[model samples]
Target: MEQEQQTICPWCMTEIVWDEEIGPEKHCPHCDNELSGYRTLQIGLDQDDQAEDEDEEDTSDEPEWDAGDEDESYGGNGSAWKDTDQGFRHTNRAWMAVEETLRRVVDEQEEAPECPSCREYMIEAGKQKLNVEPTVHGAVGRPLVQSPIETTLYVCPSCFNTSSILSDKDRERMLKALSPQD
Candidate 1:
């Protein structure tokens, strides 16, 4: 038996195993991105700078410590009013409260759908009620689609693309309505 070839998707970091009959996948299943090196970005430090850094050593003439340097404060030990001020404490507390609220909102969200364009996890914005007649071009007969369909809106943080999917309640209703009758 021939061993299957495996390739990792660069967009979503998903491991994909190619089927023998199908050969290799052209696009990633997870992120729907083309499996090509054109989209990959390479980043590294300059080789010459790295070599120079490795060869160089600390050669400062200044002493490591000076007993007379009492004016300097290393770790906020100086008499800076902002460091111990009540206003700063209040601001910090307000920021902490905002962070906690954001954390709670994130925790409450059950689904974070990946954006089709940028492969970034999308944030659920809110629900939108769309009222329009649904039509299918290839279907033999028009299936009954619920009017004023409710959909959950998603916003991609990276690309700022907006997309919507049928809400859970409406999706279930749609599936049941479209299913073949026994």
Candidate 2:
């Protein structure tokens, strides 16, 4: 039996195949663009060919650490603040969403948050379980009060971090209703 020619994407170099279901003369599914050229017995940029292009150097010179790294990581240059400084401290990317959700939960019925001892409002960024759940189920009909997902808390103003758990029962119920669905 003979095989039809295989094409590759110019942008991504992934092998392309035409599928009747996808449509005739389809784009390289890998890159989702038009396909051109015919398949050869062997195709793609060989190692030596790729290496040649890679050897070409950037025209401009820059400091080793300064090149190809995010400026924010470098403390925006020459500031007295270091990585440990409050200003330089990490903000959990999800902070605002988590804090507002938690605050709304606080506003609703039942349990009071132990009112974080920290001087500032605390934000819930993401959660983790520092310890393992006890495996054995207490009773079949009774739903296990699954352990809390340990969460990292950050102070709203300082972004100082801490953590605690509502009781297993409370945490389970609160998480179902308050935490982001997705």
Candidate 3:
């Protein structure tokens, strides 16, 4: 009897057993990622070396500031600072526009339903009417669902999966009707 060798997939964390006749697997069966260490990465750091490097400030590239030097690049004439200020203002304006658009798209619903397939927030597309037979059972005892029940349709932007939920009015009516009678 021989022991079977197992390799753990780095991408999906699934344990894979190599077959005796097939030898070792070159790729992970679960995630299909290469098991040959091509996609793997390792990082190491020394805290003492990092602390020493941080303590030594390298100012070799920086130009010395002098009051007599009136160069525009050295901020002596204030042109560098003005250019930086303008760039900052432009960046802020662009960021503000992006935030406004995001707010309009994402904040439409306070409690938006998540798509079952992609787990992304679904946007309300439109209303749909479902014709249900009165003889169909709504509950164990309750028969007769209201015909032409209205439902709100939602579409997932990411996966384009369409789903529907009962309208607020119809949901309330169904809840009230299903309540146990005194």
Residue-level lDDT tens digits of model 2 in 130-180: 554635434333333355445444334344546554445556665465444
In candidate 2, where is summed lDDT lowest over 10 consecutive residues?
136-145
Arranged by TM-score with the best first, the candidates are 3, 1, 2
Candidate 1 lDDT, 1-182, residue by residue in tens: 87799999887889999978889999998888888853654666667687677756654778866766644543334555446563554457887886676556656788877889988677789999999787753542554557788988988766889999888888887677677667
Over 52-84, each residue of candidate 3 has an lDDT whose tens digit, in order, gives 787676646656766667875747877687776
Candidate 2: segments with Cα more than 4 A from true spot: 1-115, 129-131, 135-144, 147-156, 159-161, 166-170, 173-182
Candidates 1 and 2 compared by lDDT, better number: 1
Overlapping backbone residue pairs in candidate 2 total 0
Decoy 3 TM-score against native: 0.47
Q: Please tell me which model should have the higher lDDT, number 1 or number 3.
A: 3
Candidate topping TM-score? 3
- Candidate with best lDDT: 3
Worst 10 residues of 1 by lDDT: 70-79
